[model samples]
Target chain A: MAEKRLMYGNHALVEGIIYAGCRFFAGYPITPQNEVPEYMSIRMNEVGGVFLQTESEIAAINMLFGAGAAGVRATTSSSSPGISLMQEGISYIAGADIPVLVINIVRGGPGLGNIAPAQSDYYQATKGGGHGDYFTITLAPNSAQELFEFPKLAFELAEKYRNPALILADGLLGQMMEPVEFTFEPIDPGKLPEKDYALTGCRGRPRRVVRSYDLRPGKLEELNWKRYKKYQEIIKNEQRYETFNDKDAGLIIIAYGTCARVASAAMKMARDKNLKVGLLRPITLWPFPKDKVAQLSERIKDFLVVEMNCGQMIDDVRMATQFRSRIHFLGRPGGGVPTPPEVLKKIEEIMGGGR
Target chain B: MTKEVIVAGFGGQGIVSSGIILAYAGMFEDRHVTFFPSYGAEMRGGTANCSVVISSSPVASPIVAEPDVLIIMNEPSLLRFEPRLKPNGLLLYNKTLIKSEPKRSDITIIPVPANAIAEELGQGRIANMVMLGVLAKKTGILQLATLKKAQRIRYKKASEEQLSLNDQALERGYSFL
Candidate 1:
């Protein structure tokens, strides 16, 4: 039998990292996401792992890049502002093809916004916030249990693609406590495939040099094309989503992270009110389940993209639907959480208009 | 049908853990449950709150806006969330902390002197557990046995003396009617 415990989302992430054989964590604390580093400090020490609180987010991400380049499972986490600081190092990691897990427990932002939950970083996460023609695999988890499980999936995908993976959580999901069962068998780090490009002592072999600087312009263009092709492959194979009561529904709601949790309640309220409202919650923000939304759009007449920001993800929904469905946007920007009743009202208005 | 609730209070008062116990009991009864907290800075003397949602089906929303129930552990919480309660919802107020009477007549207001009762039971911090006992009795949301099971699970690592005192506190609250 599996041991069940009521754990907060940050603690769940720590457990997930441990289960995924992540032995190193370097991060700077920020609100909503601070518990992850705190939990890692105590738990990592108990498990004989290294948890370093770096001087800054930039140093933390660079440490992660260094650790990941050495062929070790490593991670770093922060909220929106801190993640912004680490974007440059993240771009370097992507260019170097290093597998690192970066978790962003999103808070209200643009600048040092409030330490409250918000999905305002959706665009930055999905569209590659840093300067590059590169995309990181982004996973959005709405529940604490998914917060626990997503790190494992993130690590697997990061290693498989040799790319950085992001767990785009928010303050609400990061702070929540829920019963979680850690029944999966522990992953063995020794059993993983050996990396050929790692910096671990290239004895009696050709010198290994990892750099993004290709002095020849054509060589850099070829490298960019190679990375873009990898992103295309991920777009095809890694697009993931969860559909609830969407088979026969007329109105479909697209949401992610904390917003999805609220939308789920709205779906229930709509069901009770006898309105046909369903949900298509995307777990992967990048390589976004666009094909699934496109297919659902063919049958549904109306679509609503609900988020915590001022219509950041609505563009993605519109792009996915290709102007086929009547798409509407509802949001509460600047750290305000949308209530279920508010979402239900939108669903009712949309259904009444027959748009 | 399962009802979702949010209990708000200070950190040392056990409000968050009490919500966890209710959620645990709900899960034991095979109901879907979630407990989301507003801790950190709010926990250090500010207004602390947690939302617990229990449903017969897989819970749709973990965020409780107009909760079916609200257990206010302090005056601030009552003032903050009283207006957000659904009409005819259950409101359990700790009379020791909230001296003023509720203004609403639409909802069921149960004024239990939980803090005073816990003090009588020799543990001031267990006031939230006392409220839990009253909530279980008045709402019939969980059995006393299930509550005991939850208590044991929560305090399994504690000393026997602490467990006994907590058990006495729970029973005293439950017997207070």
Candidate 2:
């Protein structure tokens, strides 16, 4: 087994980036997620990587675009409002077929809402926030361990499909500390596969172009169709989720990120009192894990959807179950987080006063 | 055994650091632990608090709604966290700073003169360490040796003399009657 160390979620993200061979980072500082860039400023130097404290999120994301286009494992991070600034840059990156990593350690939002944890950016992240039709492969991790582990996975999936990847975390997950064991040894950047499409100056070969626009008729439409095929491949192969106590559950709780941890605790509390409560945690926000939710809804008639926002993920649950599973919602928008007891009470209410 | 704890104080009181040290000590012993803190404007204007969950089994929620252990380092922290303690839980307050007594009769409350003890050993900032020592002795969840080792690692940049002062403070608080 690997050695374990207590690490904060934000700092652990830097460690994960270093371990995954990401050598370029450009980010603007924001609260709750401030520790990411703060730690990156130090660790990037130690790892001999490029770390830029850009003047704005726009500058940081554009910097990421340039580095990623050059075939460097480039990344950037921001909170809700800062992330909104990166939208145009992200759309360009996605359209250009460049692999990049962007982290939104979300705080309460819509606009400078507060520096507290929230998941209100679900629609923005999943349904394509910037412009046109595009989706960043979204991953939501619930713990510091996953925060440390998901960077490598995100980078890998991004490179595999040559698409933008978003780590959709919140202030609570970013601010917490837990013991994390490094899952794999650090990868040497030199050992990673060379990119065939990178713009490497083309000294001896013919000139190449890496771009998102095409003035020629039907050229842009062809690119969109090709990207659509890749997305379908991802949806078919990459829907990830985790379930607890779902086999014989009378009521299943659907949540992700911070809310999932609270739901897990609530499930344990409900189980102690002989109430059959279960949990289904979605690891991917864009792929959405609709198949699993649909399968469970076929048998389980009761569900409680929890989120730290005004019922964002509940819509996905309702669509997955086709509005047949009697879904109950417990949403606390802005900065409010659901407690285990509060979730358990909702579970009791949904489970017909606890059988 | 699952021990949900809330340690609270002013911003400069090392409230967050003590919570991490407790969780770290538990992790060092191969137990599951989590430390979640309050950040942003709350820490700037009001009391700063952190929740720690240490359990033999895997910890689920990092947030503690009703804490079994509440360590209050300042008067404001006591006022903020006292109402949320579980019945029969343990309450350790810093007597040198907080003059008010707890109102709850169901929980066990102990007032430690953490600042006085740390001032005797030297700086007032190590009061959180003293409180941890009393917590270790009274609750038995954390071992003295583990706390010392965790303290060494957490403050690995400290000089040998400074480190020894911290150990002595923990010892003084541990031996407090």
Task: Choose the strongest candidate by TM-score.
Answer: 2
> All models: lDDT?
0.87, 0.92
User: What would the per-residue lDDT of candidate 1 be over residues A154-210, giving only the tens digit for each residue?
Assistant: 999999999999999888888887778896876777787888888988789987877
- Runs in model 1 with CA error above 4 Å? A353-355, B43-45, B152-158
The DockQ value obtained for model 1 is 0.71
lDDT of 2 by residue, B13-98 (tens): 88888998898899998999999988777645467899999999999999899999999999988888899999999999999999
Residue B106 lDDT in model 2?
97
Candidate 2 CAPRI category: high
Superposed on the true chain A, the predicted chain A of model 1 yields a TM-score of: 0.97
Worst 10 residues of 1 chain A by lDDT: A346-355
Candidate 2 global CA lDDT score:
0.92
Query: Would you list the clashing residue pairs of candidate 2?
Result: none
lDDT per residue, candidate 2, A138-239, as tens digits? 999999889999999999999999999999999999899999999999989999998988888999988878888988999889989989999999988899
Q: Model 1: per-residue lDDT, tens digit, B1-177?
A: 868798998777887778888888887877778888775456366777888987787776788889989899998889899999999999999999898888898999999899899888777888888888888888887887788778877768978888777877777778878
